[model samples]
Target: MKKILPLSATALAALIALSGCSTDTNGSSMPGMDHGSSAMSTAPPTNVGTETGADHNAADAMFAQSMLPHHSQAVEMSDIMLAKPGMDAKIVSLAKDIKAAQGPEITTMTNFLNSWGESTTMTGNHSMAGMLAGTDLDKLKASQGTEAAKMFLTQMTAHHEGALEMAKIEVSGGKNAEAVTLAKSIVSSQEAEIKAMTELLATL
Candidate 1:
């Protein structure tokens, strides 16, 4: 060797810094390294301000499951009235309105059940209130003119009353905020519809 030269301070510092930043087997820099972009890019997404599956209770689940079939029956009844000829204008309009309102409600309840990981179908053979029997539906299908309109109004009034009963239970016992809110809304709107149906029945 010609001459042994000591490394300068600047070059020594640079060497030490590079050695401190050695990467691990996974290619991520060692601890204490500035991992500005790479670290942030690999981070998992945050779920803040979102509704998760754990947000509902048993009452909420039951409300959704029960309302699905109830709303479906309302829609089916509306369809039956809509198909009948020579129906009163007011009755036809009411049937259309019932169809419009309850169809979306059915979809909303179904989604609530799905998100809560609950079955959409209600278990047990418990009969829902105000549901027309097969014979009642047959009589409705056979009637015409004012008779059909009267039957629809009478049947739908009872149906709305039954929905009000179920919704009141939800309003009192449901834990999910959205579900309770929907229950309250159903109470209000269906109450009004029931009143209107009562008035219509008087005329028919």
Candidate 2:
């Protein structure tokens, strides 16, 4: 003789069966019953488009031109430290990150300058804030081991601070939406790195 299962047991079995199959918004196979949030998943970037015309300004041009060389110098300083003996790992990592981020910004800024009919090369005194000088660079270069690492951290922290200042200026005075966006990004990313570097300096 065959026996029927209890109602609760039947319901549980039905739930399991339903969960085993699912469909997407387009009626495609959902597979594996992904009840979890797809919102958490990263999607490929879509064509959000770019800003044009009056959004750009002279301030944006200047910001890009000056920042290109400034960032280049920072990357240079970091490279120098990376090659030195007995360098701190934290500082070395910071240097590598700085090089990675700023080089791309330099290219973007140069492109902006070219598009805007402005000079890609740097101009004016870049001594805005936290910018290093001849003596400071020399000190960083000549130091050894932990001292060199410490100097690099200190100097780079200052450099990033300068970048933050410039970025703030761009946010306030820049006309181009894209330029301001990049400026804000600079402020956000560099400021975090500056804090990291500062904490690293304290440890050293």
Give a tens-digit lDDT track for model 1, residues 73-143: 88989999999988899999999998999888888888888777789998888677778888988998998
All models: lDDT?
A: 0.82, 0.76
lDDT of 2 by residue, 9-50 (tens): 887886665544432243133333444422222122211122
**What's the CA error at residue 112 for candidate 1, in Å?**
0.5
In terms of TM-score, the best-performing candidate is: 1
Q: Estimate the TM-score of every prediction.
A: 0.75, 0.70
Best by lDDT: 1
User: Candidate 1 at residue 142, lDDT?
Assistant: 92
Q: What's the alpha carbon RMSD for model 2?
A: 15.4
**What C-alpha RMSD separates each model from the true structure?**
7.9, 15.4
Off by over 4 Å in 2: 1-55, 122-126
